[model samples]
Target chain A: MVSATPTRERVLAILDTVKDPEIPVISVVELGVVRDVECGPDGVTVVITPTYSGCPAMKAMEDDIIAALDAEGIGGARVRTVFAPAWTTDWIPDGAREKLRAWGIAPPGAAHDDPPVQLRRAGRVRCPFCGAGDTTLRSEFGSTACKATHYCNSCAQPFEEFKAI
Target chain B: MSNRFFEYLLRLGDDRLVLGHRLSEWCGHGPILEEDIAMANIALDLIGQANLLLLKAASVENAGRDADALAYLRDAREYRNALIAELPRGDFAFTIARQFLFSAWALRQWEALASCRDADLAGIAARAVKESRYHVRHSAEWLVRLGDGTEESHARAQDALDELWRYTGELFLTDAIERELAHEGLAADPSAFRSAWQKDVDDVVARATLRLPAVEHWQQGGRTGLHTEHLGRMLAEMQVLPRTYPGARW
Candidate 1:
């Protein structure tokens, strides 16, 4: 039986059902974009952050949060965005990373905050399709802001890398 | 209300907005498919940052004006963007050169602002610091490539750098508004990071084999709402839809 009021856990569980609009395989909570969830007498407040500053998915995610809560009869829900510690791809947990790999997306590695910018980002990204280490970055910028395009030489398949930061 | 803070925010927001619009012009017209995507993505980031900054500015003004209103409704004369940002996107080399110069300065600017006493500004700046690092790397890499690519590419890159040098001075121009904010530790002082910016830019230019031009006369006035006659034309195209049907939504 459902409780009379939405608890923090309840709101969080609902949010877990809300998948990222860009990558539908992982939920927003799994992606760690949902910072905090609060439920009070007024209503529930879903505090979220953007994966990228200009990620178009942010609006969709916000709307999706509201819709998900509204569907559960949680009224007067509010969505707030806070950018303090800055979003990093590292926030995506190990379970979520495995899901991303299964979804044919190469999850990001450690997001080094202080690395000097390089002409070409160094390192080998294993192809998510065939688990091949031979891959070349086709473009640092990809179909989306948070992604980069890579060509797998071993499998001869094109893949997307969720960029590290 | 701190009028100076509002104006300062506007300056920061307008700079990104104008430059983002200029970059977006190359959406489909890029030299190549990858370059096209890259510019558009960068444009998205800049526009996103501008929107955030402008939203904060609107709240500070407490005038019921939203980011869109402040962005599309304001006249060119009312804009606070520096002249360098308002300049038209010239050639690919020119674009890359300007980007390198600007991003070098901006990366440091965001780094300094990350420590701002104002929590809101600091948060925005902190996020921006990460993005700006990418911007600097991307533009600097291109600058080096273009400068060393071939005779024609090198010459063009050098020419662009020389032509854009005069406008660079305005980026470091500070006034009473900025001075007060800096004193309060709520804002970054441009002069404080000037040397670091110069060193970073010089390093990239030298790597590219491009010589930095010495400006006999530094261009100014964009900070004071005096644009270089280019912002109005861009705004006309940008604001036309919003003006034609007020309150229009996509």
Candidate 2:
């Protein structure tokens, strides 16, 4: 008899339905938090990477993954977190940036290659609200560790920028 | 699984836990909203690191105790954090100076640990190094600003340095556990990072136009589980809910 076990693709498809608790607009897969899905004889393992080392949303994301898997009748699904080759904003899926912008959160800009001094000078982060480049950083940390708070001089609107780490 | 390794892990984990708690005290009390958010972010980072380190320590001990048990249940004397970490959070200048000193030392230690033989530790260290770099930059920048900003700010920053300087010697003091782990390639020698820490700290202080306090008496003993009176109060507040409602879930 052939086993009716869920395939890795099916598991991933199920995960696509799981939204990040903090950012409901993005699924874990689109955010690159879902690192891998492996199926084995004994069980299925879902590997994840946290966007920030201190992200409080990681536990919620993990629980959501497990729940999503179980809802699909996928038993013995385990979640594993890895830290090496640490998660980067670059891992964010293509077109997700535009989605993030549409959702009112500014997408992360390119990773900085400059020294700390140069990096401290506010980079041109186009405002999601006003599409203006005259935004200034109010704080390196925002409401979450993964974001930076910025204010657009043009629109006079305060926004959170997903910091590239 | 070695006792020495277990002790070493506790030392590192406890330092992060205590300092994280101290920083968390500034949650809603920051002088400004931006600083408030930054302090909370750094606190969260430190707490997250403590969770990982304590979890690793539990696994190494092979004991039934887990991270929560190790963190929230431990008595004051059972903690192995540095005395500097347990000291009360003073004014904003004091907090910034304390963070600058600790982050400077921790950044060097993490850099060395990233190359250690233990893969798990190296991975943790590698991840922590990135965060610590940002932490050091933040604290150092604050130091420069506070030192050069105004007469009052400069005096306050210098006073904070003087008061906190004595406790810093404990960071470089090595014991048998550290020596054994260092010899085994599982841990980095604390003494090895001292000069680097000193240079980095001195550079920041110099740029801030602040002078380092003269070395007089050094305070120690937190690594051996002897902390000041402050840690007990802090832990009492920190562990109350966990102890009161065992198995409480958020």
Candidate 3:
């Protein structure tokens, strides 16, 4: 945007300003939603992947990305969604995890790459607020598809964990 | 696109659409607060998958109609979902029973479709395969909990499984449409996953102390557009918004 040619770094910086509409603290880049930013002769194309298959925030995120690019005089940007390497919590970097924990959301545990259809819901999530390890899963799904609701037995406070997808 | 392919996409798309709508009905009515949220989340995933798939089908058809048009415009008789999906959302047990049954099959089916010859189809399936794993686990865990819980819960879960067992056969049917696509490597062989699905279901059923009903006449006609009376009513509710407003968007 600074050079009118729209360098990848500039596009990423702008995208960093575009926080995920659902989880406002974390930028899409930090969430690993913005897979790539391609600046071609045609124009800028922001490639993104959905955190969940039916995440409603995706449209809002797409619109926000285009709007963010357009604000810097970069118009006619295209937002494309790809699903080859499916979006995972593994994409969320550690610094953003700190931001999420500070915001009272437990960051996701490591994602499993093994076969599907396991019975037991594995892993324990400590409370982001009290850092209590004695947390019980209140629900497998939380307010968003990417998260699950949990209750901390130690502090008696409710928290959400970014589900390990 | 060939008529066969269009029809095939409808079958895939409609299953999610109808079932998603049914699950959405549980939004405010779930037995527990967590379940209400879970049902709505699952519904969102299904409808989201349906949106992507039906959009692809519309593109292939080269018709002016888009995914919304296909989903909102189509009537009950025109719907191609399996009968098992269109069955009325009965009790909480019934809902979990159907979820366990179908998600088990969908897990296997989507797994096969994950490597489909068509890139668009494969991409959709690959992402959905991940979602289906959670669906299978969530529903399967509930099936066990409810089936093994107490006298009342066990009875209800068993009764629900018995009533819904007949419709499970329809999913495994490999008719000409599926055969043609499977032959071309564009679709999974529907019958190929039946045994694995059975084992998966049986394992959970056994753990839950629930009994599968003795095999009766397998109900199979949903593929050919023959559905139960339930589909028409469900479609009437689903299509009402689009039909009434036409191009209305919020």
Candidate 4:
């Protein structure tokens, strides 16, 4: 028999186990697209808003969310999408940023506090490999939708930067 | 509460779907590897936008036909895509011209749509505006490059502008449906966006050293389910599998 943990606590616990496919250090909870979590007698419904619609990891993330919840006996949970107040980089947890850097992926830069009339210059990203702030962007798009390919001059390594989606 | 909002949304969705299908035709035949990938990515983005807009439109219409049915099973005449989207992507210049004009107009329209009275429409609009903004920027960047690249490229780019200019007027004109929706605050007042779109395109054209084609006797009636011959061929390719095997899932 499984232990009867409180619904909200159980859901939160399940979410903690849902890791990002590319970078294993951070979970979906840390990524912060999982906007609302509702638990009730019927089941749990995890309302997740994707960082980008074209992000390929969304399917894997959905499967992970379901599996994690099911492992805790929270079966029959419906994962719905809510796009209102569309996602921004501000939602990523502080700890996850460190984890991404530790895992050799440059974390996203901070979100602009104010909205500017003109397009701002692209953010400067530090190289995760050598911790150099002098990396040059090779391509705005990389292997994945959420990442940009950059070459670190100091480290002499071509690495992917987790672009703010 | 207005049916016009649903109508407006379907028009937007259909335009994306039609154009996306046209672009997808070049999956393996793109001029270069990078271009092929870029076009494919843009196609995917447009198709995804179509899905969101159509699904939301269906939900609001309370129609039994969901987005899949609307996308895969609609007849050619039943589609309400703009003439511009249905026009063939003749060359790189033609495709870029279409992208430039469409993306510029879409960015302005989506900005207005983000504040729609309907929450669902507003939600989709908010998400889509970001994507369209990127699309516009990408196309605008390319426009400047190709328009000023070489004599041949510049000439071709100018010719594309001349060819596609007629279709630009259809995007901003409002029908009874749009007018009603605008009154309800459920849809963007397209008329209000005309100057903004013009100014945006003017800047791009000025930078590209290309002349803006005059809007002479703009073609209308696309919003009323009328479309060019290209739309029929497009629908045939896009709808074949779904129509042949109804209720099919992948």
Find the candidate with the highest DockQ and give its number. Answer: 3
C-alpha TM-score for every candidate: 0.97, 0.94, 0.97, 0.90
**lDDT per residue (tens digit) for residues B1-250 in model 1:** 2688999999999989999999999999999998899899999999999999999999999899999999999999999999999889999999988887887888888889989987888888888887887787888888998999999999999999989999999999999899999999877899998888887877788899999988899999988899888999999998999999998887
Candidate 1 CAPRI classification by DockQ: medium
Residues A98-148, model 3: lDDT tens digits: 999999999988888545567878768989999989989888888989888
lDDT (10s digit) by residue, model 2, range B1-250: 3788889999999999999999999999999999999999999999999998999999999989999999999999999999999999999999999999998888888889888887878878877876787788788889999998899999999999999999999999998778888998988898886777888888889989999988779999998888899999999999999999999997
Compose the digit string of candidate 4's lDDT tens values, residues A104-153: 77888875432211222366788887888887866555556566668899
Docking class of 3: medium
Using DockQ as the yardstick, the better of models 2 and 3 is 3
TM-score of 4: 0.90
lDDT by candidate, in order shown: 0.89, 0.87, 0.89, 0.79
DockQ score for candidate 2:
0.49
What is candidate 1's lDDT per residue for A70-92, written digit by digit as tens?
89888678999998878888888
- Each candidate's DockQ score against the native complex? 0.69, 0.49, 0.73, 0.39
**Where's the lowest-lDDT run of ten residues in candidate 1 chain A?**
A113-122
Count of clashing residue pairs in every prediction: 0, 0, 0, 0
Q: Among all windows of ten consecutive residues in candidate 3 chain A, which has the lowest summed lDDT?
A: A113-122
Candidate 1: where is the Cα deviation over 4 Å?
A: A1-3
Chain B TM-scores per candidate, in order, are: 0.98, 0.98, 0.98, 0.95
What is the Cα-based lDDT of residue A162 in candidate 4?
74
